[model samples]
Target: MIKCIPMIIKGVVQDFDNNACKEINLDSGNKIKLSLLTEDSVLRSLNSKEKVDLNLNQIVNFLYTVGQRWKNEEYNRRRTYIRELKKYLGYSDEMARLEANWIAMLLCSKSALYDIVNYDLGSIHVLDEWLPRGDCYVKAQAKGVSIHLLAGNVPLSGVTSILRAILTKNECIIKTSSSDPFTATALASSFIDVNAEHPITKSMSVMYWPHNEDMTLPQRIMNHADIVIAWGGEEAIKWAAKHSPPHADVLKFGPKKSLSIIEEPEDMEEAAMGVAHDICFYDQQACFSTQDVYYIGEHLPLFLSELEKQLDRYAKILPKGLKNFDEKAAFSLTEREGIFAGYDVKKGDNQAWLMIISPTNSSGNQPLSRSVYIHQVSDINEVLPFVNKNSTQTVSIYPWEASLKYRDKLAMSGAERIVESGMNNIFRVGGAHDSLSPLQYLVRFTSHERPFHYTTKDVAVEIEQTRYLEEDKFLVFVP
Candidate 1:
């Protein structure tokens, strides 16, 4: 914990001041100094990494400490943090607390076990026996697990990775996002307070540094860690991969693209309003948030109008980025004024929204700001080809029942998650983003295919469903 303090500090700097995060206003947007001993600075010092080294005992202690802290006062501390965070980020206190409580629940819950086992939709049941794999088992012991949490600007995506490591009883060294620095640190502080002697407390580290800062710190830490968990965009993932040691197991969580396929909208007002939440949630910063919507029916023009009216309401809440507004204006001027067809495509007060409607060849364009490329299609099938590789993460359907009829076709379109909810926030946040979850990435799962069975003749029977079933159990009873 001591050795990695600087790393957490560095990350806090970037989380608070990420070019995108800093552009928005939160709590007067006061700039704080967030820096660490640079790579050069570390080289100048003697035994820089020595302070963070830990034996097995300390690692176990840290995990216990984390459990105690979370078990005691996580909710209260998190509520306080949420209030401050809302003020800092300029978000609604209600919304912030809701999201914060969700994060806290995820951090403290034992749900990672379910997230890993229930890979598919199924009822929960208990298994009485132990399963083992080659050099790994159902209860695999991890020694030094270094978790590099690549935070998304979205609410709790980053914390999932950290929670996963903790559940596995790994000595977690979390690299939290620079955009939201203190969430993880505060959680860790809570643990340190509960039982300072716990190995998990001594084992945990939360800090931040710029991607360009001393790569050696993370590299060394990664080399020491048995597993490395990372979450972020392509650039962040690429950097983490480069810095991670060759022998370390890399569990990557990268940014994903999502979309909405609407069947019909009564009018433009309705379509616009429904799609507005997808764009405005966390300012459309979530990886699963939709950047494009393709309406599959002749009702689109009316849908667009209804969408516009509803969007106008949201414009009062969240706003668009300055750069995003300028770019759209430039495109509209040069491409002829009628491109939007008299549609009001401009920045609103409070940077609440930026609605852009233009004729696009397809929905393949990368999403930016609070923008969604509204594409009109004659059939939902016609839009299938437009889903690029990144569509593996999200596709929310309007009136999900009708969409399920063509579900097979939609799955072929490469979407991992489909729901009736038109808004992205309706999608469960703790699950995997592109076919992988935190537990799937943070802990290794290996299975043994060998079968172990005891016939009635081979073992004592516990119960019989009926007389006929009892006859089948006679062999075990005789034995």
Candidate 2:
């Protein structure tokens, strides 16, 4: 355990300021001090220089290399880091291992990284141009400087924003969360293991300060950023937005909840198993984790029973995460509500999992820890209004074909994405996120005009000739 958390400034570790540093363990048990670096020095360094300047090819290679270091068994950092997360944050071994696996899956592979590049900035130029332009050409460029206000519910958020910033060749400063502060350093260590002097390593700095109402360091950093990416609940997102000045572009990934819709045709047992997986994974802390399960079927009881069995099995495999007093009390309140409403309630001896089948109404605020709220609906449409288009993110459907049929309706209803059941959390880097090409939004584009390109008459003639030669292939650039 790092007793004194190191403060990173311009790729090197800096000493703790005796007057500024304060040590307090927020009951996480693996105690460490918060490295409260002074505002003046950090701001001076940020404004003084541009540390990153890698071309697209070099950026791709750099990330791929970092991934190899994490995946390679010889490296002690990845394994030790994951174990530390489990110990420090009270995550179950399975959950911790799963988190590690996700990192490897998402970042380690060359294909995934390339997928992101191609999907966002088409062909290193204009992508998916519905119409063609003859004179203009466009290319994506970094936004110069970025600040990421990361969320603590999951450690993955820290690395994800880092990847986007680096891939886009932007110099970035990551404000790490109190809950999972170690990931930023672990990622930097992984990069150092591969190539310490690489532009990405040199350009990135990760540090932390307590979230205070008075808006100090974070607000100043946000105000100066070219791009500010905030990941958190509604309140946190709002706070970040308030600090961000007009010139700074802000992207908010706020509190989102996902749900699954199961039809009667689907196998009840298999459906229950899928729901069990989503609920049990991450101990329900992840945004994509399922809280409300809406079923359109007659075998609700059978599905509920199978779900209980699966939860019982997973309880043994991935034991319940330790909870603080507040969390435990919240769980008790939800359980008592179920009992008071006469909803069928059940629990294993370990109390690692809880099931409230056929709850008449569920609290918008969920007790998200191995707990589930099942709602029986005669028609799937009954669940639509509750989805609350603004807040609801991913909606999983049972039958694969059904998703195809209901996709448009779901989109019209404000659902961001519709996927097959059990796969709401699994997404390709190139795939639409929050119904957007997220990478594209992080970048700015530079437009170029070829010298006196074709005249109006020449352009018309060129279009006709081009149409005759290859009608299907085309390109367009927005001026």
Candidate 3:
């Protein structure tokens, strides 16, 4: 069977002639056809006027309702989307379902959205109206058009990017990743399903063009952007940076790695389970997913044994996605290299998972499918040298209290986020991503200054400045 995925332009579905459509072969032997948008069509779509004007509360409510629909397992769109993921991306049933649940959680949590605005901009109302600040009324204005270059490894990332732009009241022009084009389209369809004419829905346009194939359309689109949010590996990030207009604000969510630190937990089983969850949640694909474990203190062998059991359990519960021949070869070679290097190697049956324990802080190419490297250290501080600011993202710590002791050092070492061993995937409210609040980059903070009649904090009165300058009284007024 062939599935035809259409582009969503300003809340309308667009279908092109068969000649303009490209067919993609999926890992499950299924096929999907995507219509390519012409330059004129995209330009026209971009020029279409925004249909409705809505406030923050209205947009949130609409998104919440859409989220409620997705929360239902039997919702037609949600079910179809999960099935499509399984068919097109080779995701296991459980994994696909998990992704749907995450989407529900992201949208339904309305407070988090408001909190993001408040935390980054100093007031949630800043987006809707000018709020009084010191000596001025400040407002956050949406940077006109936001162009998103999404990554495929994590579908929720693209959704988050679009949501941020919407929350800031910016027009969104999303370029979907070829590896996973269905997620953003499905999200836009859901918006249309809720209310086609809603301003938030009408402000979004989701489409795709092969990266680097023809630079004409991308260049034109980049030229029109007020801000650009780029996500993916180094190459993709570079491409976005290189093509973005000089006047546009570019935000990059590039490649990052995470790790775990076990500081002699009281319950080795529980600690091991947490670490295993971090390792298996996204199969080490997310930046927050644990790639290495630094075990401090004793019971290292017991922790490893328990981790193995937990990993086996996850294999049956949330089975991994399919790996191509090259991936399989890389996994096997990494395991062999560990053995050749005289490191302790442990693997699961049928290559379900692999763990390599090294005597020192040694590293190599990570196969990244439930593969973890463990290093033994006498103290947690020893892990600092391995943490690099430019590339380190989340550092998970066992025995939650241990975080307080090492968080300062970890932050100084370039770790962007610190979380409990099991909570790597859940980004809490008020936390910074990639060392910056993403919303801050999507909008411009404009301040309305107070009138001259407003008195200065230092001086008693605000008289004419020329009079003070002519009288040589500026020094007295400054005091």
The TM-scores, one per candidate, come to: 0.69, 0.89, 0.97
Please write out the lDDT profile of model 1 over residues 1-479, one tens digit for every residue.
11122333211212232231212222335333333434443232222221223332343355444444444445566656666466454456555655665664554444443444344212112121234533233433343556565673764665556655654456666666656665677666666566554445555666555676556655555566667777778888887788777777777767777778788644444455557777666666787777777777776667766666666676555443234345455434533443435543544444444455554462222335566667777776676776656545677777666567766887777777776534566536445556655444443433444333323333444434365365775454455
Query: Measured by TM-score, how close is model 3 to the native structure?
Result: 0.97
lDDT of 3 by residue, 1-479 (tens): 57777777887888655776678776566787877778665686668545335678887888899999999998888998898888788888999999999999988989988887789777878888888888999988888889999999999999899888888888888899877888898888899888888788888788877775777766887788889999999999999999999999899999999999999989998899899999998778898899999999888999998999999998999898877677778899999999999999999887789999996558777999899999999986789988999799999999999999999999999999999999998888889999998898888889999987798788778767888888988887767
Q: Which run of 10 residues does model 3 get worst, by summed lDDT?
A: 45-54
**Model 2 segments more than 4 A misplaced:** 125-134, 359-365, 451-453, 456-479
In the order shown, what is each candidate's alpha-carbon RMSD? 9.4, 5.8, 1.4
lDDT preference between candidates 1 and 3, better one = 3
**lDDT over C-alpha atoms for residue 412 of model 3:** 90
Measured with C-alpha atoms, the lDDT of residue 299 in candidate 2 is 83
Q: How many times do residue backbones clash in model 3?
A: 1
Order of the predicted models by lDDT, top scorer first: 3, 2, 1
Quote the positional error of residue 144 for candidate 3 in Å: 1.4
Question: Judged by TM-score relative to the true structure, which candidate is superior, 1 or 2?
Answer: 2
TM-score of 1: 0.69
Tens digit of per-residue lDDT, candidate 2, span 1-479? 55666667656667777577657565456676767758754675466546466566677777777776677755688788777777777777777777776676656676677667777777543322222344666666678778888887877877788887877778878888877777887887677777777777777777787777445665666666888888988887987888778987888888888888888755766777777877877778777788888888788888888888888877887777778778877888888888887878887665677787764355633688878788899885787776767777888888777778767777888887777767866765556767667677777776666553354543433344456447653442111
